[model samples]
Target chain A: MPTIFVYVDQFKGAALSASWETMGAAKKLAGEMGANVTALVFGHNVEGIAKESFAYGADSATLCDDPTLADFRAQPYAALLAKVCADGKPDVVLGPNTTRGRDLFGMAAALLGASAVADGIGLALKDGAVHVTRPAYAGKLLSTVVAKSRRPQMITLRPRAFPKPEAGAGASGSVTKVEPAMKEDDIATKVTGYSVEEGRVNLADARIIVSGGRGVGGPDGFAPVRELAATLGGAVGASRAAVDAGWIPYANQVGQTGRTVSPDLYVACGISGAIQHQAGMRTSKLIVAINKDAEAPIFKLARYGIVGDLFKILPALSAEFKKRLGK
Target chain B: MHVVACIKQTPDTAAKVEVKDGHVTWGDAALVVNPWDEYAVEEALRLKEKHEGKATAICMGPESAKEALKTCLAMGCDEAILISDPALKGSDSTATATVLAAAIRKMGDVDIAVFGKQAIDGDTGFTAVAVAATLGWNALTFLSKIESLDPAGKTIVVERSLEEGKQLCSSKLPAAISVVKDINEPRYPSFMGIRKAAKANVPVWSAADIGVEASQVGAAGSAVTWPEIYPLPAREGSVEILEGSPEEIAAKLADGLIAEKVI
Candidate 1:
């Protein structure tokens, strides 16, 4: 029987929530293709993550727990992943399009001499092959791509594109152990250290986002935006103009050149909404625009618009939300 | 040190790209070097200047791609090359990487190959690592800063910007690195440099010139196929502008969000 392999992306032992979402997508695809879903987990001391995959819908899993795989060096990880797919002969392989996911899958696909469809928003079985629907031209158009005859069709699912599966405590699956493909000495890249920024919600996974733009005036302008985001338990985003103006860090940028986000609620504060900025947040379920200029382009795409000063509007909105939600 | 900056020609970021009659088109929109590639070219030139090394720009596209190469040259690249072939049309990222790997090999002794984070059009962000895999080189992607470079020792250290945080990494030379927008600010081409680029001779290589067979390139070599192309469903823009005092407007908007169940 055909099998769909999903890579379980974990960092420091905890699997990313997107991995479960990918498993959900894989399960759906398996149902359509009459295939089994197998989770592939690789990391140091990641046996628990492997076992947890079962609760998220994996019928079986292959685990490679090695110290060398602790840090995500593409060389060893891709080599091992390529080897597993080669040995298992899975019909399809799916992974989340995170930073490491894209890096690993790209190199692994090259090693296997197969094509990988990255950032797929939709998938379906068509004519005995998996067709991936992905955004092109920075979300302006959607293209359905397929690996016509490549074995182990590789694809990376966009974060938040699929629903996360509910985990049941009693769910279980068969687990298999795999040996590391390469030793530490053989890898060329070395992870010297990591500096993590704590207490900030990741924009890619955030359900709600409040963004600021040039009209924020300066670095201090993000105070209200940040307050509203914190009140709503969401992430704060900035427009390219704001980032370019040094008002915020590049990590907070949202646009074609920055990060593409699809959140449930996207609130635009003091933003003119350039096309490039629209490219990033057009997929949001609900858009609210707030700007002093009624003529701002953002008003055209927003479901709700407030033509007033954001400084006053943002504070008022946050207070109202605080009272209503009893926060 | 010899650095090769790989670039592509894409529609301007402001272009309104649309799919008409099963084809993607950006009508009357100017095509320029991919926005991200400018950072790559800028970084390559900086590396060249710092190490007194040679920098070359290479691109894969039709005859019109020469304009993109010219932009790179005008941005201070030492020279430029365009890899073009009639048979290279409809190539996927893998096939394109294969040709690029072959081209890099044809150049020979290249110490580093630089690329942008990703092209705005395809947005795969896969070419740098794919090329590295093909050439058996270290792939350092999403690099925000090149901390140190030791040409004599053949080593490089860089800070990679990942989702979780910034990671400091070290690698041996002959590496392929893709830079993010935070790396450097791209400078506009100088008047003199623009004049030099207008007259620069960018040699175009074919599939056979790089010793890659026609079967190993273009549609025949691509594993992925685009079976369909279409626009996203149009978003309804029936915007309801809220009125009244700031407090009143906020209350009404909150109620609307609650009704929509998106908050």
Candidate 2:
């Protein structure tokens, strides 16, 4: 039977949620190929993550536990994972498409000489080949890549692309520690400090996003958009017009070159929608536009439009929302 | 302080490209040095200008990437070395990194390696770290500004950008750093710089010259495959479109939101 290796990362004993998403992908492939899915736990001291990996549909987890592996460095991690892959002979390997995953995937692929498809949004099995779909051209287009390679096909699945499996009832798996080929100098990069960005929930993962544009006038004009987002427990986003205006931070910008989001609700306030901006948020489930110019291009795609200044509309909506919420 | 900036002639950042038969054909699309790599080159020049060192631009791409190479030269790189091979078509990030590491090794005396955080196309943010891993160098990513470098002390200080704000870190020499867009405003090529870049000799390296087997340089060596390309999913912005007075539109939008349970 074939084997699949799913990498589930843990920081301070808690596994990243996206790694469970990878396990879901691995599980489906395991069903089709009759392969047993295994998770690899690195840098975790306790058995908490290993047992949870089994609960998430992994058959077994091979733990590479060494205090030296405590810090996350690509070199030692890659060398260690390569040793595991060589010994395990996984027919397929899955990882979350993230910063850490990107580094680990590249190093592992180079060392294992395996084909790696990255940031894939979905997977399709066709004619005995796994076809993975991913965004390119900065989310302007999607590319479906196939790995016509041998054993240990590697893929980094995109966030929120698939459903994470529900925890099984009383799930458990075997655990073993595999020795790795890591030298002391291999872990050269030091984690001097870490500063996690705390703000609006990651806009990429938010289901509701309220975005402003240059028409909002300037950075000072974004307070209403921020307020509206807060009212709905949503994230705040901005158009390229706003980002380039230096009105809002570039990280909040929604455009082809920026982060792509598929929120359930996308509200565009005081903005003329450009093609690039549309490309990023086009897949948003619902689009509401509030532009003073009735002829604005954004109105064309907006399901609902209010031809007025965002300053007027956002406050009205916020007040109305509060009223409805009995505030 | 010797500085080596690894650059690539990525498709113009603004160019929209498509994959056809496993090749990126930016037909009608302008080609330029990657936006981030240009920053990498400019940052290199800035460090050299301040610290009194030499910054050589090393590019790994096809011969045609000479345009990018020339631009790098015009931007004031001391030298240009091209790592191009026929077998390197469709090289994934890993293969690309491997080839780059070998090419840099061949081009010795490299204490520091700088790269654009990522090429715009793949946005994998992997190649710089991968090369660092293979070359046994420390990796720093998303750098906003290099505060200072003291080769004598073998240490460097820089602000590394995170999603919220930038963190300041000082790493040892011989490390790999990927700079972001805001690192420094990349200088426009002056006429004199353009002339110098145009007249500069860019030595091209084959796979053998770089000491990497041809099979291990391109698509053949890549483990991740680019097998499919497709148009993105179409979103039907509600056919339940509302055309009405401002009051009515707001009312309908509100009702629509309520109907959709979004409120």
User: What DockQ does each listed candidate score?
Assistant: 0.83, 0.44
Tell me how candidate 2 scores on lDDT: 0.77
Interface RMSD for model 2 amounts to 3.2
Identify the candidate with maximal DockQ: 1
> What is the DockQ (computed on Cα atoms) for candidate 2?
0.44
In candidate 2, what are the lDDT values of residues A221-283, reduced to their tens digit? Answer: 999999989888899998877887778776787776456677879999987887668767876
Candidate 2: regions farther than 4 A off: A10-13, A44-46, A64-71, A177-186, A197-200, A293-306, A323-327, B16-27, B157-159, B162-170, B237-251, B261-263
CAPRI quality band, candidate 1 = high
- Model 1 sits at an interface RMSD, in angstroms, of 1.2
Model 1 per-residue lDDT tens digits across residues A276-310: 99989988889999999999999988999999999
Predicted model with the maximum lDDT: 1
Q: Chain B, model 2, TM-score against the native? A: 0.91
What's every prediction's RMSD, in angstroms? Answer: 1.0, 3.2
